[model samples]
Each structure stands twice: as structure tokens, then as C-alpha cells.
Target: MNLAKNRNEIDPKFKWDIEKIYADTETWNKEFQEIKTLAPKLKEYEGKLNNAETLYEFLQLEEKVSRKLYLLLIYAFLKSDEDTTQNQYQALKSKIQAFAAEFGSYVSFMNPELLSLPEGTMEKFLEEKEELKLYKFMIEDLLRNKPHVLSQKEEALLASAEDIFGAPQNIYNIFSNADLKFPQITNEEGEKVDFTESSYFKYIISKNRDVRKEAFEALFGTYESFKNTIATSLTASTKKFAFMAKTKKFNSSIEYALSPLNIPVSVYDNLIETINNNLNLLHRYVDVKKKLLGVDELHMYDLYVPVIDVPDMHIEFQEGVDMVKEGIKPLGEEYLNIFQEGIDNRWIDVYENKGKRNGAYSWGSYDTMPYVLLNYNFKYNDVSTLAHEMGHSLHSYYSRKEQPFVYSNYTLFCAEVASTVNECLLINDRISKETDKKKKLYYINEQLEQIRGTVFRQTMFAEFERETHKLIDAGTPLTSEELNDIYYNLNKKYYGDKMVIDDLIKVEWARIPHFYRDFYVYQYSTGYSAAMSFTSAILRDGEEAVERYKGFLKSGGSDYSINILKKAGVDMTTTKPVQDTMDRFKELLDMLEAEL
Candidate 1:
């Protein structure tokens, strides 16, 4: 049997080029020291930003410091993620994080001071200094948050507490990724294999019911032992958001979280309301799964198993890249060229190794190539994840290439759109070309599951998050039992009476890392809805739609997420996108039902 390899055992070609950011730790340390001194220079411009030249000088100096600081932080984080157990890189990460807090405190006065400027003063400064015109949008955004800008001293106090605010997430990460352990389980061949967080999904989708049930029980049961500890960590994290929201004078934590990107609370409400209205469709899909699997009871462990049998197909990393290239050809030559460049330059770290971080993400700084991290297990889902993460990388690639440092990063509200669009395109390409009936049914099933997971499942998590935060706001304690009850009930509601709603599934909420980010999962649902809209348009209008979609990719945070998506042709404020996604889910369900 194949076992997980050590990081050194993996081929160098499969790993991302970390040295591209910094040659060595010595070089990183030297720059770290240099950046520490530059923050003082920023503090020097505190009271003197009223004048045009001084403000311009301050902005330039701040940008220089910020850019360098972000580069340092990125290097530290990448190194730490490469091996979570390595104390040297972990210490390096901690040092950078602490300094980042210090840096935030040092510059915290800038916003309050800038907001204090006389009306039209910033516009006059833009006219006075040609270089300051580049920062006009950023300045306008800052002024837009004037009501929330605290006094200089109060801002400094909050900024200095950044590390404290981040402790819950840090603790949870170390505990889950580096410390947690699972017992060995027997596979279908009666061979004992290690049941790990990275391999749990592999077993949970096994053809053998016993293997799936054992894997499910072992994974969540391990989490159950430490459920209370995780509950405390999650509660502290939620309360932090509540405190910060009330301190900033927002109506609630959700409003506070969404306000930064100019997203209205109505968007969040619309997602839950629309999904609730369409819960019958999900129930219908669940009923179909139960009937197709020919099971007496469909439990949580049975949800992910493929309904139809297909030959086992293992997708090699290069094979997956070639498939993605073909799948995304509709985006035209330029987009494919950039995508190919990333593959050639080793912008991805493929294959799982012991001690590496679990799951996947796309990360980099303004100065570095957008890099992807994955635990590639030779599954088709890994291939799809390749398309998903590269979607993020290319989005970052385009945004950083086109926008300045200030607006280079897009908001989380629109972050999932580009990635989901890639998945939709890839699955559509496969379904369009596959000639075999079983294979066609498989692709259709895959797309349906993607919608169920990204749209329906994530919306459930969104509702769970909203409900928990509301409890915290009402001064109610969120205990282990409370979190479990909330999560278990939502599963019952979303899955309907068709699913068994297993007892062990209650601990599932503790396993979600996104809970630390506060109200982030909802965007996955909304973004997937918007991506379906774009995918349909591209399929229909050809180059006209592709060009508009590319324009949306190039647009970073220069405008609000809603405005940017609107320019790209979808208006997310209404129920249209959600309705479109529901319609697609039903259409696929009909196709699968007929084929079966």
C-alpha cells in the first residue's frame, strides 16, 4: 500500500518555488530588521498629513513599508505552511505576526487623521499632487468609513491588540493541523491504513459501506473527544467579532464584516431566504440519491458516495493540468498562455506530505507569483481543485498585474467567483465531450454535487454562523452542546427527512476552519450563483461574454464587489443569480434522473 511521503521524499518539481520570494532565511531576517525601522518614519508624519506634499510623502513611505512588510509576512506564512511542525519557521512566522501588529499600531493614526481633514481637502490634494491621484479611490474608501474611524488613541489601542484578536485562530490551527491524530482503519482490501484528516475524504467516498462508516466514525469521534476545547476556541473567536463590531458602532457582526466591501446585509439575508425557499429541490436530490444507492437509510457518510459505478480513474498531476488547459480554452489564448506560464514556473505545490498543512489555498504577495498549495491524491476531485485554486491564483495574477498595491487584493465577497467559474467550465467541457452514457452520468452527478456542496451546504454553514453570532450578540453562551444542536438541526433541515442525520455528525462544526474567519462561507454560495450566471453567458455569447468576464477578472478592488460584478453583467443584489443556480441544479437533476 502507498503511504504518505515526507516533504523531502516528494520531487522538487512538484513543490512550489519558495526561494522565489527570498533566497534564504538570512535575507528574510535582514529585510525584517530594515522594515522595522521604516515604521518609525511613518509615525513621523502623524500630525503633519494636512499638507499636500507631506501627505503624498507619507503615503509613498507607507506604501513602501506596507509592500515590504506584506512580502515578509507572505514568506513567513508560506514557510510555516510547508511544514507546520518546523519550529524555526513557526518562530519566524510568530516574529513577523507580532511585528505586523506593531506596524498596525504605528500607522493606526493615519486613517483617523485623514478622515479629520476638511471636506474637499483630499480632492484639492489630488489636484495639487499628480502622484496622489493614484490613491484617490483608496482615499475615498477611507473617508466612506468615517463614522467607524475611532479616535487616534483608541485606534492605536485596538491595533495593538491585533495579536490578541488572532490568538483563537492561531491556537485552533496549531491544534487541528499539527497536533490532532486519528486511529488506523481497515480499507476495503482488509489492509490497515492510517486514517488522517487528509485521507478522510478518500475513505468516506469508498465503495465499501463498512469503510465509509468506519472512516466517518473515526474522524468525527476523534474530534468529539476534543470538542469542548474546540468549542471554547470558536466561542472566543465569535465573541471577538462581536466586541469589535460593537466597538466600531456597527449594527451587528455581520454588518461589520460585510461593510468593508460595501456589501449590504440584504445580500446575506437574500441567500438564506432563497435557499430556504428552494430546500425542496435539495430534498428531491436527496431522495434521488437514496433511491439510486438502493439503501434502506441514507446517512451522512453515504452522502458523498457516487450513486453510479464507474471504472477507477487516477488523474496524474500533469494530466490534470493538460485537462484544465483544454477545459478553459473558451477564455481565449491570452488567458491560457498565463495559465501555462504558471504551470511552467512551478507556481503549484502538488502532492500531500506528512506535516504539511491540510486542504488547499492560493496565496502570494503583490511582489511574488501567486502560488497554490494542494494535497493532490490522484483523484478527479484533486483535478477540479487544481482548476479551483488556479482560478484564485490567476485572479490574483491579473489583479496584481493590473492594479496598484492599494487595490491589488479583492474582497472575500467576490473571491470565490473566479474559482467556481473554472469548475463550471471544466465540468461542462467534460459533459459535452463524453460519449459513454455512464461517464456522462458521472460528470452530471459531479456538477450536481458541486452545487449541493458549494451552494446548499455552504448556505447551511452560513445560516449556522449567523445564528451563532446572533446568540453571542444576545449575551448567550455558546457551549459545546449548543453548537452541536445548532449544526445537527441544520443538517436535518437541509437534508430533509431522507438523510439519517447521524448522531456523530453533530461534531462536524468543530472541523470547519472557516468559522474562524467570521461569516465567510456565505460568499461561497453567492459567488457560485454568480459564476453560474457568467458560465451560461459565456457558453451562449462566445467571445462577447468571455471579454466581459476577463474584464471582471482584471478589476480588483477598484470599485465595490457588487459594482464590479454588475459591470461584468450579473446583478447579485436581487434573487436572479440564486434562482439561476437553483434552475441549473434542477436541470442537471432531470438529466441524471433520465439517464439513470
Candidate 2:
């Protein structure tokens, strides 16, 4: 049961060797010092935007320095997240953040000055610096801020003050990751199960009603103790956002937040409208789940129970890789080949271990390959997670290959699409291919959970964020009780009478860190639905869908998030993608009922 001590070692087969990025910590430190010294050289270009060649060299130097800085910063953060309590690791991580704040301050004027360049300065800069070729989109990204980039002094003021503004997220992170502890719950064997945030999901989703209830209650009840602190942190986070919006001259915080993605508020509105229309289908699926579980009462805890209690459905690590490859082959050979490189080249760190980062994400820098971190427990869920993370990695890989470093960073909107596309494809493919009925049911439930968590539940969070922000905007203070009421009510709307709506679920919003990002959670809803629509198109239309989806991946930030989605075939501005996703959920629920 003690994975950290017993099965703690990450299998060489699953571990990625980051040594290739820097070789060793000593080497990294040496490089870090070198990078620190390189900062002052950037000051050489402080006021040098009069000509194309000067701007070009300055931009190239800046980009090169930034690439090195990014690699260094990520390595430190990744290493620290793997174990935050380590003093040395914390020091390294803190140094990186502090350095980054300074680095950002140093380069803050690059944008304001670049925009200040004579009318044709941009065209000439691009023509002059052949090396700036990679940075065309990068420069244009700055140009996009032409409407917003304040003067050099104002921009520097904002940049230097970033650390001061990050107090909310920093406090939340410190409290959640380090300060809080959950009550121990006795397992079926009558042994006390010591719960960590890493293992909270396992307990709260246990098949035993008592385990789920106790875990859910104890975990959240612990959060209740710190609700005041959390609320204060949230207020700071909100005010930080509001201050930035005011300073940027945007009419509202939402507009300022979304302007970078080039997406209009209508897209966000369209998603909520679409989800609102289709929520009945989601409720219907919840109804089916309730009946299938045959529980007299369906609580929030019941939602995560194993629809099938069978545990051996856990596949081996190698088999999980095979499953992901097979699941994604629908995208074509070249696509699969690139993914295989990720698999073989240790682009992934699979399996849970002592001090490993909890959960999973796809991470890497534009200068490096996209790497995935997984705490795999071999459940069918892990298999799906593997596919999901690879989706992000390959998306990064492809965009890096197709676009320059400047255009390399894809918008969060597209980022989720790549991941969800693989997730949906894997779930659908696994369900379609399986012959064992109980296992088939497990497979089906797994897919349903995807919709439940991603498409439906996230929209619920999106709604929560919308209203919560409005609460702030309207000059109404959101106490824990008020926040909970809004969130709990949304849960009721989405799940209806089918599930036991618990009081504890109201505090869920406080626990979710994504709320700090402001208007970001809606992307999960939009992304899931968009993935479903695009996946359906690819499954039915084959080559055309694949090409469009691939083109969408390579688009990076070249287009608005909504426009990229629309061009890729799922028009988020319309309700069709949302409706299509809901219809698919209904079909799956109908099939699961027939099979059961």
C-alpha cells in the first residue's frame, strides 16, 4: 500500500531522463549562473528600437536568453513539485521565480518599445533579422498588445510588481500543498488509511459508501477550518486580476483576461448557453448512473464509485502504452510515429513514486521536447490518463516542429483540444473494441466519467466562476457560505434529483486552484465539447478531419482561440459542438443501460 517506499522507483521504462536537458544539477547551476550574467546584456537593447537590424538582434538575443531561462525555470519547478518540502529544492525553485520576476522586469519594455517603433518598424525588423524569422509571431503577439502595452515606465512598474501581486496564488499553493492535513479513515481491513492530497481521490472514490462519505466529509471539513484564509487569498487573487484589468485599460477583467487569446466574450457566452441547453442530457446520464449503482441514495461521493467493482482491469505499463498507440492510430501513421518517439525517447515519466508530483500534466519548454509526468496506478483510469497526457505532448511536439519558437506556444484552448481529442478517442476506441461485458461496462463507465468530469462538471465550474466573479463585480462579498450556495446550486442544476447533493460539495470551489486563473475553467468545457465534435468528424470523415485537426494544432496563437476551433470544425460560437457532445453522452448512456 506504501507506493513511495515499496514500489517507489520509477521504472526506467517509464522514467524520462532529464539529464539530456542539462546533464546534472551541477551543470544546471553553472548554466544558471551564466544565465544570470546574461541578463545585463539585455539592457544593451533598452532603447535600441530605431532600426530593423538593431531590433532584430535585440529580439534574437532576448529569445535565446529566454529559451535558456525557460529550460532552467521549468527544471527547477518540476524538480521541486516532485518534492516541495526539500529545502534545497525549494531554494532552487524560489530562486527561479525571483529571477523570472527580475527577468520579466528587465524585458518589460521590449513590447512597449517594439510597438513604439516607427509605423513600418515591424515589417523592416522582420526583414532585417533573418533570425527573427522564428519570432514573427512572437513580435506580432507584442503587436496584439499595441492597444494595451503601456509606456516603457508603466510596463516596467507592472512587471517589477508581479511578485507582490502573486500573493493570492502563492498563499493558496503554500496552504494546499503543505499546510493542511486530512483525517485518517479506516479502510475495509480496519487499518487507518493516512490520507494525503495525493491519495484523497482514491479514498473519496472508493466503492464503500462509508469510505467515500467519510473521506469526502473529513477532507472538506478540514478545508472548512481554513475557509477564511482561503477566502482572503481568493479576494487577493481577484483584486490582483481587477487591478491588472484597470491598469490595462480594458473595460472589464474578463476582456483583459481573454484579449491575449483573441477570443471574444461571445465564445465564452456561447459555451455557457450551449451547456445550459444540453444539461438535461447530462442529468439523464446521472440518472442512469444512479439506477445502475442501485443505491437508495446517490451522493456526490457515489458519482466516482466503480460502476463495475472489478479491479483487475488495471493493465501493465507497457500495455498502457500499446493502448494509447492503438487508440491514437486513427490520427494516421505519421502522427503515431511522432508519439512513438515520445514513448521511446522517455518523453514521459509514468507510474507513481515517492516524492513524485501528484496527478499528471504535459510539460516542457519550446527549446526542449514535451514531457509528461504521471503517477500511474494501473487502473483503466491510468490508461486514459496516459493517452490524455500524450495528447498534450504530441500537440506540443507537432507545434514545435511546425512553427517557430515564437508561434510554438499554443493557446490553452488548443492545448486542451489536443489532450481531450486523445482522451475521447481512447475512451471511444476502448469501448468499441472490448468484448467482455463487465469489462465493457467498466470501459463504458470510464468514458462516461470523461464526459462527467470534463464536459459537464467543468461547465459547472465555469458557471461557478462566472457567478463568483459577478458577485465580486456587484460589490457583494463572497463568504464561504455564499460561494458554496452558488456552487451547490449549480451542482443541483446539472445533476438534478438523480444524485445526493451534499452540503460539503459547496467548498469545492475553494479547493480548485483554477479559479485563480479567471475565466479559464470554461475552456475545459469548451475543450471537451470541441474535442467531441472534432473527434466525431475525424472518425466519420477520416483524412479531412485529421488534416484540419493537425492544422489547428500547428496554428498556435496565430488565430483567435475560437477562430482556430471554428476553422478546425467545431464552432464554439455555435451550439452544435455542445449539442453534439451532449447527444453522444446520451447515446453512451443509452448503450450502457441496454448492456447492463
Candidate 3:
């Protein structure tokens, strides 16, 4: 697959119309300056938050400025992601970062001040001003953290330290995506290809064992060369989280991270425990792979390659769009119209370019169309990715339309549920309609892999994160050697004795960018489980389930994540969701084994 070396060479229709965010750079600059000017004015309302009218006024002004600031910031961030090397957009993005820190510092007093108000003042304010009802949840959520709220000066210091706190992640992004280079490897066709971050997935899943093995070795080998550097980078990030947690008086970094979402550490522990108890199922799946691949032993590189040889299912971009449209018909015509409009308009950046960001994501502000970025390779998984990201976009669209701006942005805990549910709908629809035995088998295999990747694999990642943070909290230094050993042992525990755990796979943790975000990967597991619950409901109850699912999307941050999911019929606070997900995986594995 040859990639375009220049962005201009790609068709305009294939690229996202990010220009629609602003008419031009001048217009963006105009708004940028306006935000800078408007931000500091919030200081005038600093001490006056004690008064009902002044508090209402300050909240209104804060929302207005925040909406505009996000629009400008999202545009610059997406533009910079398109080509990280572009100095112009890079500078634009840096300017927004600095402005954001300054703005955050200026507004930092609001929460602490609001928390300091007389015990019943906020409730009285809410009663006196009907207009303030729009912000009732926002105010209450802030006050709920009264114990964690620092003094105004301390809050300002933490706000000002935002950029300094995020330096490690910034550095990792630069080194991983911009500076690092992979060695050239020979492909199946005997052509030498430069292994890049975007190309890593393509090579790793190759049908040819030699090609993928070489690619895997070359990629992790490059990471191994910088093992110490990457280890130190990750350590700094972990320490940053620990420092913040201690300063905020939380019991643990993981606790601090999940508190905002109102999730308990037990939920995290439940996932790890469930996955540990079910390792034998994963081992069984691996054993199936070893037997089907007819290998004496299964290595890490061989796990991704398909066991059943079905004809290649190459889907073009428009075909993928059409297929996705049909797959989601269960969501009703109104939902279909929104999906079609996003695809018809330039809501998605469809194809990869020279320096565009790798991977796919859906992002936007409350005031704008939800935008999706894709490095589309026209494969079956690309279509699945389209379905997944469109789930996120549609969730944003509904939330923005139904809820106030303050509650429009849902937490990551619920965000993944929306996306994974889409993937479930797509996969189930495809499997039901596929007539050819081989293709049906292929779809079954895909479902199996989905459970493996999203459920089992992510749980492994979540456990790694939990253990590493605990180790750091316990005063163990995370040097390269120690990190590698801990990771290798985790691999052994997860994989059991079913497969050969290669030394190269031990360094895999060095390449994961998600680790920097701290306790984030677990959401993928929980979301997938919740999605399975939704899929079962839709299948069982028909339109009733559809309405309930849509209600969950529109609920947004209007309530807590678990409550939102409960309304959708899944209670995540217990061990039931994880068990249900494991049961679903077992059912799928049974079908695949019977077919084999």
C-alpha cells in the first residue's frame, strides 16, 4: 500500500473540511485574540461569587468563554495533528496551549470559591435564580468535591501547573510519533518497506508469518533500543500522577483518576479479578489458534494472523459507508439520517496522508459537528473502525442537542460503551446476513478477535497499569530492567503456558501511549461489556431496547456514568457486566470451535 507523500496529492473530498471550523487562518486568529481578551475578565467576579446574581453572571460568562476557547483549541489541535511537522500549525497549537493554561489559571478560583460559600448558599442561589437551574448539576458536582478543594491560591497554582504537569506526555508524543524511526523490512512481495507507526498494524497482521515476524521484531527492536529513555518518560508521567494524587489527598493515583467520573476502585478491581479467573478461556482460544495454524508452538506474532483462510474482503470507502449505514438500521431512521449527513458532509477525514495522525478518533466541541479522523486502508477492520468512531460522533451529537453545554461532554467510562455498541451492532448484522460459509466463518472469527482484543487484551493492559502505579506508590523505581521484568511476568500470568512468550514482547509496554493517561484503558473493557448487554437487549426487546439505548446516549453527563448505564439497563457497579462479557466471549468461542 503506497502512501501519499504530500497532503496536497490527496483529493479534497477525502480530507476533513477543518477549514469549516474557521473561514481561514485570519478568522481563527481573530477568535484566538478574542478569547485571550475575554479570559481575564472573569477575575472581576472572583470574590463576588458569594452573591447569587454575581455567581449566576460569572457562570454564564465562563460557559460562553469556554465554548469559544474549545472551538479554537480543537481546530488548532486537529490541524496540528494532520501534520505534526508543520511549523505553522505547530506554533498555532502551542499558542492555544499557553492561552488555555492562562485561562485555566484565571478561572481556577471559581470551584474553590463556590465550595467555600455558606453551606446552603448554592441551594438558595439555585432557588432564587431560575436561570441558574441550567447549572445545578455542575455546581453540585463541584461542591461534592469539597474535601478535595484547595484554597484559592493553591487551586491557582495547580491550574498554572497544567502544562508543566503534562510535559512528559508531550515529550513522549514528540519522541514516539515525530522523532522515532523504524528500520526497513522486506514485505511478502519482496519489496523493502519503511516500517512506520501507521504501517505497524498492517505489517503485524500480515498473512505471511516471515513478513509479520520481521516487522514485529524490527518495531519492538527499535523500542528496545530506547527502552531506558521510554521507561524514564513513562516513570515521569506516573510520578506526576502520584504527586497530584498526594497533593489532592487521595488514597491512590487510580482513585484520584476515577473520582471525577464517580467510579469506585472496586469496578477496576472487579475487571482485573474477572479477567484473571477467566485466563483459561484466553488460553483455550490461543490453543485453538496454535492447532488451526498447524504450528508446533504459537508466538506472540502469530496471534493476529487469521487461522481460517477466507478470500480477502477488500471494501472501498463508500462501500464501507453504505455497509455501515445498513448495519445500524436498527437504531431507526432518525439516527440513520444523522449518520448519513455526517458521512455526506466532511465530518470525517477519510484517508491517511504523509504526516496525519495515526489511529482513529471522534472529537468536536458542543457547538460544532462531531469530527472523525481515520487512516483508512479499505480493510474490513477499517469499516469496523468507521462503525466504532461513528458511534462516538453520534453520541456527541445527541448529547450536544439534548443536554446543556455544561453536561454535554460524557466521561470516558460511558464514551467507550457508545462506540463498542456500534461495533457489536455492525458485527451481528454482518454475521446474520452473510450466506457464504467461509465469510460467515470469517465474521465469527472477527467477533472472537473483538472479544480477545477489547475485552481480554485491554484487561491485561489495565492490570499492568494498576500494578505499575502501585509499585511506584510503594517506592519501587521503574527502571528499564524492572519495568521489563514486571511486564514479562504479567504476560506469563495472562497467557499461561499455552504460548511462547517472546522476549521482544516484554518491551511492548514501552510503546503504549495510553499508559501515560493513567488508569484509562480499563474503560475499554467495561464499555465492551456494557455494549454486549445493550446488544442483547436490542435483540431481545426490539424497539424498546433501541429507545432505551438512545436515551443513554442523550443522557450524556446529565448524570453519573453508572447511573446513565443503569438507565440503559446495565449496572456496572457489580461483577455482573464483566461476567456477562466473559460469558459472551465463551459463547462465541464455542461457535467458532464447532465450526472448526
State residue 154's C-alpha deviation in candidate 2, in Å: 4.3
Q: In model 3, what are the clashing residue pairs, if there are any?
A: none
Model 3 / residue 220 / CA error / Å: 4.6
Worst 10 residues of 3 by lDDT: 1-10
Q: Pick the candidate with the highest lDDT.
A: 1
Candidate 3 residues 184-213, lDDT tens each?
Answer: 999989999788978988988888999989
Clashes of each: 0, 1, 0
Candidate 2 structure quality by residue, lDDT tens digits, 501-575: 888887877789998889888888787888899889989999989999998888776656777778888788788
| CA shift of 346, model 3, Å | 5.0
Residue 481 accuracy (lDDT) in model 1: 97
Ten-residue region with minimum lDDT total, candidate 2:
1-10
Candidate 3: residue 328 Cα off by (Å): 1.4
TM-scores vs. true structure, each candidate:
0.85, 0.87, 0.87
What is candidate 2's CA lDDT for residue 286? 75
Clashes of 2: 1
Clashing pairs in 2: 298-500
Candidate 2 wrong stretches, greater than 4 Å: 1-19, 22-39, 70-102, 116-136, 151-164, 170-199, 221-233, 350-359, 375-377
TM-score of candidate 3 versus the correct structure, residues matched by position: 0.87
